[model samples]
Target: MNRTMVTAVNTLGQLHKQVDLIGHNLANAETAGYKSREASFADLMAQQINNYSSAGSEVGRQSPLGIRQSPGARISQTAMLSKQGSLKTTGRPLDIAFTKENQYLKVRVQEDGTSQIRFTRNGELDIVNAGDQWVLATKDGHLVLDENDQVITFSGKVEEVKMIQPGTLEATMDNGQNIAFRLGVIALNKPQYLEQMGNTLLGLPDGADNNINQIYSDLNGARRQEISLQQGVLEASNVDIGKEMTDLMASQRSIQFQSRSITLADQMMGLVNGIR
Candidate 1:
């Protein structure tokens, strides 16, 4: 294959990948708490061409062989967007939104009712009948617990789960009830580095100190703040549809341009081959 042609083909492949990513972002634009990813492009190695050494003897001699450039740019990484999405309101008591400084709720999720705890910020709360009482749950249908508690799945509908401020609850009910939830205090020194476990929960990542005091600093005070849990209001998704549409158009155009370039290169190659 000709060097330039090979490079163009590689670039075309990268563009296709980028288009796919853009399509995905647009598709999930309305999904609750969905984050958009951006594709990153990187140039392939550049070939050093036309080395001109201007010493007295070598001034006039121009090199005929040009250094070969590798195939075009490639899609490198899809960086995750950490930007805060705009919060929309739906008036429902279970629908709680986080206004706190980088705090999320912890809930239990599973294929069955027996799944482990995961973290999420989709803080729409609900109630489930955990055998005896009702308990709180996060949106996306996870049962919220006070501690690492098991969920009591019910065959019927649940009613009356309360949303206390975060850090108020010491333990949670198995059926999404907040019986133990009360005004309380947790003394954590380094709360900022909490690892995100999907579904409104945070935990100590492995090889890190679970002991809150090991990371405690007098300057780094972990003061308690109350999270307002609005009853009957849910937080809507943060995806910006306008931004996603713009990105989709840009990716589509780039793909089309690359496809055209490849087609033109192929036509030129065919002409050369036809020459007798």
Candidate 2:
């Protein structure tokens, strides 16, 4: 009805979105290698109108001499926090964790009968028997990509595996042969462009590589970036429970305040209509 009510209603919708985001982060608090998301708000377009034509009485006033009408605020960005989480020792040979911030392991996810490359920090790895060979994969069955961005497949039986060095996995085959697979990792050059797919995977928007810097490695070393990973350990989720709760409470308060404003505006309109 009025600008006050309209603005309040609009802002309330955005605040609810922030609350939903906070809840999502809290729900994933125990998910390994999960990163927290932070939402930011930006004010909508505002109209500045001169309420008074006379500046005679407002000569010494320091504030602006106009009424600003805004349609409230909206969630501008929900940036992913890439801070490193605490390392947890799982004692499992396949459980791995990245030791550096902004570093993510590469995996191939199948969608719509095609394989797409995605990045993730979750390191719960497993070896599965493919049709003809054994392949390294995530717990969700996404194929693990090696230094060449190719599927890490072994021709023989992998009896055991361990991390002998950073980003390198040493696998002992059943025939007493030791094969080393260097995992592929990418440093997030522009994580803001990443979209969150399901199964703890983060993917590029529309499969664009312009947001990433190529840094695959060979047996010798990486071309531009180096990665560090340790076996038998997993990275805890970076979500801070206490902070999320606090944010949720604050958002609820704001919603309540905005709702009250809308109610007051409605009452004022009713009173004006009923003027005697």
Candidate 3:
């Protein structure tokens, strides 16, 4: 295949991948606590020619110059945008929204008989009966964990649940005992390192520190005062429909132009071969 055609093909493939990412962002525009990803492209290194000496001076001879050929563009990386989304009031007691950035609620999930800790921005939760105890759970039934990294359970029937302050919850039981538990709200050191675990949940990569110590430090400092949690509210996805539509159009146009370039390259090759 011709070099121009090869380059065009590679670029077209990258544009297609970008189109897929845009489609994904559009699909999750309404998903709560969803973060959008932006795709970046990078060009390959240019070809270089070794040192050409001008000692063999031929009159009116031009010096040999290195050829800068672009192999093609490639999807360098897809980075998650950390912009905060708008909050929607749901008026539900279990719904919560974080006013601070890079914060997430911690939850525990049972997979293959083993429990794994996961982090999520979605605060829609409910109460579930796990055997003999009633524990706070996400909508998907994953147990919501407390600061101790243990499942938060009510000692008796929960009569009322209220947020006394950010990262703190107070509940009144039917037996007249009021229990207060600190909500496991944590700030990630590097949220970009978080891996999406489906259902708007993110999991810490293996070997990556949970950053629990950082959370503790923040709680002890004045940063804790900046963290605010709003009950009865949920965060909407941070996707802008207008921007996504513009990106989709641009990608489509680029794909068309690349296809035309490949076709022209093929035709030029045919003409070269036909020369007698």
- lDDT, candidate 3, at 219: 43
How much does candidate 2 score in TM-score?
Answer: 0.90
Taking all chains together, each candidate's TM-score versus the true structure is: 0.64, 0.90, 0.85
Per-residue lDDT tens digits for candidate 2, residues 1-276, read 698998999999999999999999999999988999999999999899988868797888888888787889999999999889999998999999988887888899998999899888999999999988999999889999987889999998899998777788899999999999888877776677788886368987774655355432232364424667788999999999999999999999999999999999999999999999
In terms of TM-score, the best-performing candidate is: 2
Instruction: Please list the residue runs of candidate 1 whose C-alpha ends up more than 4 Å from where it truly belongs after superposition.
Output: 45-70, 100-102, 111-117, 129-135, 145-159, 167-178, 182-232
Q: Which stretches of candidate 2 lie over 4 Å from their true place?
A: 58-65, 214-225
With candidate 1 superimposed using the best TM-score fit, by how many Å does residue 106's alpha carbon deviate from the native? 2.6
Cα miss at 183, model 2 (Å)?
0.3
Task: Sort all candidates by TM-score, best to worst.
Answer: 2, 3, 1
| Candidate 3: RMSD to truth | 3.8
Q: Give candidate 3 misplaced runs (Cα > 4 Å).
A: 50-65, 110-114, 210-226
CA RMSD of each candidate after superposition: 7.0, 2.6, 3.8
- What is the Å distance of residue 237 in model 3 from its true position? 1.1
Local distance difference test, per candidate? 0.56, 0.87, 0.82
lDDT of 1 by residue, 104-142 (tens): 455566735556544455655556556755455555666
